[model samples]
Target: MPPTSVAAPPGAVTAAERSLAPDLARGVMLLVIAVVHAHILHTLAHGGAAPSGVADTVTTVVVLAFGEGRGYPMFAALFGYGLASVYARRTARGDTWPATRSLIRRRGRWLFVFGILHTLLLFFGDILAVYGLIALLFAGMLVRSDRRLLVWGAVWAVAGTGVYALVNNLLVADVEGATQVLAHPLTDIATRAMTWPAMAPLLLITSVFPFLVGVWAARRDVLTAPERNRALLARTAAVGIPVGVVGGLPYALVSAGVWAAGPGTATATGWVFMLTGYAGGFGYAALIALVAARMGARRGPVATALAACGERSMTSYLLQSVAWIVLFAPYMLDLAVRVNGTAAVAMGVGVWAATVVLADVLRRAGIRGPAESALRRLTYGPRHSARGAAAGQPAARR
Candidate 1:
């Protein structure tokens, strides 16, 4: 086999961090992704129960605290930064803008494929689908000025978040408020995933804005040279946390009933959440990436584990669905009906912690996380053959 070589697309990073540091951020972000899925499952089962057992109580409190809106927003932010990472690497390597654009397109296609499989076979609650669709739209803006991207991104993100918040809780007296949105599981999932007159443009703007922000951060070398970017991250956090709190809290609260959506009213409050929520979510993405950079790679066991998980998010995310179905399905473990807000959070967190430890173990054993290895092989496994040689890595994953 040819030697295992992982080349940065030119200047993706300094030689110093060509190791596992970036993966650490990826892993923790994946773990944070659980927040939205867990709550959605509980709502499916019990119409959204409150804190139950002692364990459940604590989890509920955390959900109300910051956990609710925290994770997804952060995920969006990372999406932006990661985009930057790629753009920079390519540009540095003398690959023109077109080469990088093609690369992102390919990456987005893979993301879309992964997302579709994830949404259908696993939980209906999958970001990959939405992200994939949005990416197609996101590609159009690659040539826009950074300022223009930011402007349009801000407009769309704000509008989309508002629309979701407004529509999420408002309900008809006949139908169950935002539960109407949840009807037809896969169809709803698909509606959200596909390009549509109703939601396509709105979602594209929101997601694209973040993608652009990531492009900006990457252009600025924020993640690659985090120390220099500290003040920016800090400033973003200052504005973003409160924005997320204000905007994100209501979705969780109304959904959880700390506030009221009323029996029949279509949720109107979703509007307030729009811009603030993106501000919050992107803020999280910014801060988390900042923190991970400071923490560095190969320092902490927890970080190593998180990076491993991130490296294999495709598998880890899908596995999370399988776990939920078996554990909480009526015909499965049926834990969904038995669990409430706080308890549910515990289960989710416990799963997250477990993913970390297991990933850590895999790294130590010189193994890739199950899904990540598959993805790498699928994308890169055949590249070696074109070089007129056997793949340095297995041509096909076993």
Candidate 2:
């Protein structure tokens, strides 16, 4: 449970429960994703050669090491955490449950639309539509008992990842026959948009398990009271971080040609990737939640800022697309080659910091961030309008 002083009094949002760590982490991760894509777009535009420099080398190594498989996991897990939160809040209100299925379906639709536009106009590498689909699919698990939710969620996720990993392992393992084997579908927009076959497994590996794990954590009040779960978290990271480092690192490097191997070896290494992801992914989520619980942004500028951003996460996500388009659009300044690997990473880090500052400033002004305000209106507007209309009806005389 949350600290006694910080816990809500049987209702409503609480000041103490707001922590911006996840938002900042999420922003940072998205920024990294942007930078990486910028580099890849440059590569695609210029036949796989980024500008050579010390900065490029460091960026390449760091991106290869830390940027490959981690960010998506974190984002997906956070999404799950959000799901758990919404479900809990709805169930607690004793009000009619929202049409969650319809809600998620609409969200998925928006994601698909947004993702298609993003892929075509800007970057071909996109995950939004698929992530949205997976979220809708996973919504059914919200009401399950904790154990069954965790276990079955894990089963579905692992099975999905295993099948896709098999495909990736077989297709990606070969260097000599790579061109002849198969391209990453469109190697561009078409693949990322509505390629349901490819996306099904990708979603399972990339987002689903972490999401369920997040739901599990929320169930236990793990974030609200992390000190109570420190030992579990420490043990988790101890096991997970190393596995992620030792096992997952190789596959990424192999893909980069550091230790390219056969299909069998690639298949073996892919297991390591998934294992470390589950282990380390769980560890990271728990650790962050615990960190938030203990050293919360309870009553200060930081807390205020993060809470605003968290409330507006969907908005912020969309805003990121806008920000990137403005920054990278060829017609804007034709900066396709100007931003290199290292600079892109730096920009990512910087953008995240800017977002935090922006969040805080928006909070102080009593103005919602553009994204937050939009989502708020979108989410609650219709229901509120309906309620208002009903409340004005004349009472019946008995």
Candidate 3:
């Protein structure tokens, strides 16, 4: 395969020049993220509920099949993929390793700051901080060979899974107790902030493996060169989805109370379920890329809208939490107490749809998402005159 070309200077690529796959994948995955989070918030609203009614059972099964343990890893893999691409672009443009690393470190540092604020103000399960921390630790590994990247990824996955299993044994959190903290707005933020010291470790451990795999994928330029890697993408999707679903099935059954298992066995089994998402994440990416390769420049309004959402994913992600707070927070609409599993899922979809529309509007107006603009400004400073020097281009947008 020919070596893929680097992207245009940051802030140079307009909507017309943007690739379809990565953005489209991000757009589609936001819906998945919204649904999984909706389920979490819904569980909190109810103070917890089993898969009882027909609606709950169906919704729970759908989540088990595709939502839970699936979306986050997929997004994490994409995060790594984009991070690796940025590193490649910078180095290929003649930037020194030290300078390139500094660029990424600055970006990651800002992301962690954003994540902290997002968690304290909106959602405790903020992933930006975890991604930032992990990227800071391992972004340099993108320069490693493919074989080394995959080998270490596998190692991290196994070791991290073990760490999670041990943590589960040592610190079994009371789900009910955590949910109750959301009963009042003032206490909710404090309680969620407090849980982070414990929750962050688990998220970090579970995330590293997939993030590494994403870096490996970026080395191949899969998203940028989708036309060159159709067979690989198809094979990944063919194998990943079923394996992820099967591995996750036991946990799904256990979650819905359709299967009986000892607590220790369940914890171990949950680890297995989480690990399979590594495959699922790759599969989702490959499938989306293949679709984009076929679509080419023929995308219509809906596709354009989705790609726009993906382009502005950071903003969309934050906005999703704001929507959740408005509808479910006790100090807000307080609808969590009145909504069921089916209703919550519907609401999540509604919120995601709104974001898609908003993203399209921003694109039409030739505006960047607020968060994306802020991040670009922070990472690259004010855009200088286009000097056309490889060394002078703005940093690649994450």
Q: Could you give candidate 3's per-residue lDDT for residues 1-398 as a string of tens digits?
A: 22224433542343444578989999998998999888878876765556568778778777876777788888888888888877877777787878878878888898888988898899978898888898788877878888888798889898887787667545534564345436677798898799788878888988988888788888887888899999999999999988888888877776666777788777877788788877777788789999999988687778888988998999999999999999989889988778788898899999999999998887776577888777766777655212212221222121
TM-score for each candidate, following the candidate numbering = 0.78, 0.74, 0.91
Q: Which residue segments of model 1 deviate by more than 4 Å?
A: 1-22, 48-61, 170-205, 261-268, 293-298, 377-381, 384-398
- Candidate 3 ranges with C-alpha deviation above 4 Å: 1-17, 165-173, 177-181, 384-398
lDDT of 1 by residue, 1-398 (tens): 23334542232332223334345556766655665567657755664444345555445544544555455544555666665566666666688987777666666677777776765555655666566665555765656687887797677666666555544443222333233123344664464445233333344444655666666666676666667778887888788877767655654555444565663332544555445656766566567657776775435656656766765566677777777767666656778777566566567777777676776666565455566444444433445223212221232121
State candidate 2's TM-score: 0.74
The candidate scoring highest on TM-score is 3
Clashing pairs in 3: none
Against the true structure, candidate 3 has what lDDT?
0.79
lDDT of 2 by residue, 1-398 (tens): 23422222221233234344555445445555555555544444333443467666556655645555666676777767766776677677653444655555555566666565655544444566666676667677777788887787778666856765787665443323221101232443344344445544565565777777778877766655567778876787677656666666766555555565787777767766765656655555555555566665353555445545554455555555555555555445434457666665566556555666765565555454454333333444645433322332211000
Steric overlap count per candidate: 21, 0, 0
